[model samples]
Target: MQDILIVDGYNVIGAWTELKKLQKNDFELARDFLINKLSEYQAVTGWRVILIFDAYLISGKETKTKKSKIEVIYTKKSEKADQKIEGLIKKLQNVKTRIHVATSDMAEQWAVFSQGALRKPSRELIEEIGQIEKEIKRSTANTHRSSSMTKIQLDDATREKLEQMRRGF
Candidate 1:
């Protein structure tokens, strides 16, 4: 089954320490950071990510989706981001599709859950992101583990050179 993630953008920014601090200084920075973070999460997890942010006086217009390999929506001026998320949950959910919603808002979590969408708190999402980063680092490391794991032996001449260096010989 294909996995889909519907993220509450402002909610996540408010929940994540780094994002919250960035938001305090620059709204654009926070917005960009959220997009980049979601992009990374999508790349690592192979999930379809859709991010929603609220707008005022949304004209009951069709959602404007930014396709940067992920869907980003600025709620059509009148709708709250949460409302848009609920609409999306209704539209995207099916028996074969696994939908996960990320937000710290309890009401939103319950609402999405009632729609058969699973909920993940922002902190737990961050921890999972950290684990993904660590996995990526370990997998990309240049260190030679193959030889050590097999207990391969070093030649006597190489060992002697190491011993001479240790004794200043």
Candidate 2:
């Protein structure tokens, strides 16, 4: 069974301070930042991540794209992200799947919960991402240290030959 995380894009952008600051200057930058962060989270967790952004005010059909192995969805005109998320929960929920919806909206939390999907508040998701990043850094440092300490075993003759080659002998 696989875990799925569905994020409400704007909701999280509003909730996260860094994203909110970027949004004040450039909306696209904020969205891109969120997508990149989510991509990293998806890579670390091995969960299927789907991020939904509201396109309800614009006139167009729903659009879905893949970014860094994660899904990015833009709701169609007149269709809110909340609606699309709920629809996705209904379509994807099953006994073998664990669905988690990330949003700070109370109404949305309740809605997804009632559909048997778990609710992860935006604040919680932010903290989880922070922890994951720290783990990655620690793991990378350990790997580097271990690799640098590794010694390759060589016969005496081979070692002498390598040393001679290094001196251009």
Candidate 3:
């Protein structure tokens, strides 16, 4: 069973400095940025990521969509993201499946722990994502270096000449 990561979208946005700054100018853009980051995190960690945004104050039905292989959920009217996240933890928790909830809410963390799911603070999640991104950069650099090296194809005679030169022949 794959690991699951449930993110409380607004909470994370409030906790993350970059997102908070972006949110001040454009809320939608901040949300989109968060989703994009989570998508990358999901790809790197191979975890099923579900990001929940609260629409409790907005009169509308709940919406769920898939973006870059990650799930984005807007909670229904009168339903908070925390409630939805808890519900998901309850539904997905099992011996073989490891569920993680990311939020800065202490109450939410306790609730998640009670449901047998792991809790990741928003700051911690940010750090984890940063580490993953660094790893990706390093891996990409290594791949580029290797591909460049392989791109230079030498003929058998050229290879033999270089080998003899190296041997001082």
Q: Which sections of candidate 2 miss by over 4 Å?
A: 151-169
Q: Is candidate 1 or candidate 3 better by lDDT?
A: 3
Top candidate on lDDT is: 2
Give the residue spans of candidate 3 off by over 4 A: 151-169
lDDT of each: 0.86, 0.94, 0.92
Q: 1-169 in candidate 1: lDDT tens per residue?
A: 9999988988989988898999989988898888877787899989999988886644666466665577988887767889999999999888889999999999999999999999999888878877887877786663456545777478999989989999999
Residues 38-89, model 3: lDDT tens digits: 9889888899999999996579899999988879999998899999998998
In angstroms, the error of model 1 at 42 is 0.8
The window of 10 residues in a row where model 1 has the poorest summed lDDT is 139-148
> What does the lDDT read for residue 73 in candidate 1?
86
Which residue ranges in model 1 land beyond 4 Å of their true spot?
57-63, 143-169
RMSD of each: 7.0, 3.5, 5.2
Ordered from best to worst TM-score, the candidate numbers read: 2, 3, 1
